[model samples]
Structure formats: C-alpha cells, structure tokens
Target: MKVTVFYSSDATKSAAFDVQPSDTVKSVKQKVIALHSPPDWANTALLAEKDSTEYFDNRKRLAQCGVVDGAVLKFTYARNLTLMEKVELNVQGTDTGNFQLPPMSISTLPPKVAAY
Candidate 1:
C-alpha cells in the first residue's frame, strides 16, 4: 500500500511512500528524513490526520493508528514556544535552544498523577 505524508504547514509539500500496514510510524518518519527530509527534520513526528485522539507512540503501527493505504499523515513539529523559550529568544546574546515540545491537550490525569 502507498501512503503519503504531507507537511501540516503546507499541504502542497508532501512525500509518498510504499509501506505495509504493520510498518511503525517511526519508520515512516525516518523514511521522510532519509529520502526527502523537510526543513528542520530532526526530532520531527508523524501525526495521523484521522486520529489525533492519543499520542502516536513511535512503536505504534500505521494500521493501529488508523493510517490506512492512501491516507495522508500530517508531518508536524512543535510550533509554540514556552515562556522560557520566548524569554531566551528576546534576551540579547542568548543562544537559541533546540528543545521542542510535542503537541498535547488537556486530559484526565494519569493513574500516577491522579493517585498523587
């Protein structure tokens, strides 16, 4: 089956790949980086447009994540900056940091956090 990964920022830019349903999301991302890496490719992630319910674990299979053949996955990266990041960028002579947070949403506390 063939899958195309498109840049979340620009749909016009995308890359297609021939992969099996069992292929891991990590492999797809690696393929993009290896064959046609987008800008700032390091530490990038592949997000499923159809299912953004939970975090896409690196080991998760494309089929498990609802990424079927012909499905277009969003090639996304962290966009917003944290408070410290904003400050660092504004402060003169400060070197830019390379840290990038993953996309997240407010949800019920985890078992550990809820217990606490």
Candidate 2:
C-alpha cells in the first residue's frame, strides 16, 4: 500500500511510502511523524481524505476506510491562532502597495482578554 503524507507548514510537501495492506491510518501517521519530525507547535493531527471526501478517524472501524494503492493521505498543520488575531493579518499583493482584505468581524470579547 502506497501512502502519501502531506506536511503543511510555511509551505506544503508530499511524501510517499509503501506500507502493508493491513496498515491503519494511525500506523501511517506514526510513520509520517517519524519521517518528518514536527515542531512542538504542530501536534500530529491528520485530515485523511480521498477524492475530496474526508475519512472519519473512527479508531474502532479502521478497515471501513479502504486503503488501496494510490490513495492520497494529506497531513495538515493547524494554525493555533484566535479568530480575531487571524482577521488582523495584513495581506500584500505582488506589487508594493496593493493590499486587499475582507471586512473584519468585530469580537465581543474585551481587549483585556488575551489572544494567543
């Protein structure tokens, strides 16, 4: 079974590996974790999908999600940021001063409430 591990960070990359047909997603994740050591900020979290449909990580029914050849396993790094903090980020265009942004959603939380 050929599985692909996608690591999301400052950039994205795909890593392909061969495993047994009986291999589980959890096993595959362990292999990926060993291959690409993630930083402390990124605790190994996976979003296993095939053809745009996400596979549920029900540990009980591992075999339900068929593991065939050429199945794409995408590994993603979740951004640990508050909703308000995400909105404050500035986006810049290729050319110097071209900046575009969507309307910000004001937070009801008080300013004294610390944002990570």
Candidate 3:
C-alpha cells in the first residue's frame, strides 16, 4: 500500500511512502521527519485528509486509525515559530514584541505581496 503525505507548511511539497496497515503512526512520523527534516521544536501529526482536522494517535496503527491504501495524509507540525515567521520577526528588528497578525495564506495574497 502507498500513502501520500502532504506537508502542512507547504502543500506543494508532498511525498509518497510504501506502507502497511500494521504500520504505526509513530513509525510513519519518523519517516516523514527524516524526509522533511522539520525544525527541532516541531512535532508532527497526521491528518487523514486535506480538510480533516482530526489527527491519528502515534500509538495507533494505520488500519486502526481508519487509514487505507492510497490515503492522503496531511503532515502537520506544532512548533515555536516557522522559518518565515522568524524572518519576519528579524526584519522588524526585534526579538520580542506584542504584535499580532492574522495568518495569511500564500494563495490569497497578491503575487507581489506573497513573493516576499
């Protein structure tokens, strides 16, 4: 069985892995971490689908989590700060601040605005 994993930070980046129903989520997460090399503070979670918010438990097998062959799982991370966010903070010339901005999707921003 093959499973497609999509990175939450960058949907354009995805990887397909050959897996078995018996494979545990933790094992899959290890594979993904090896391939993507996410930040040290980042923790990976597997979402069953693109629109699904529910995540699978690391202790559960793929079969037990309702994952089937050819399923598309979204690989997401919980971290301190993303690279982009860090850059933005640095550009502001401050290590600590009380500014809060709404999350912006690259697709929604104008090409020129999104370019930076």
- TM-score to native of every candidate shown: 0.56, 0.52, 0.62
Which regions in candidate 3 have their CA more than 4 angstroms from the true location? 43-47, 80-116
Q: Tens digit of lDDT per residue, candidate 2, span 1-116?
A: 56666665533577888877666667777777787777778644565763444744726233467666776767664455444444454322223323444455676776685779
Clashes of each: 0, 0, 0
lDDT of 3 by residue, 9-115 (tens): 76688899999999999899888878877667765445556669887888999999888889988887775565668668768986744556556565655566454
Which one wins on TM-score? 3
What residue pairs are clashing in model 1? none
Residue 56 lDDT in candidate 2:
46
Task: State, as a TM-score between 0 and 1, how close model 2 is to the true structure.
Answer: 0.52
Superposed by TM-score, candidate 2 places the C-alpha of residue 75 at a distance from the truth, in angstroms, of: 0.8
Report the Cα lDDT for candidate 3: 0.78
Pairs that clash in candidate 3: none
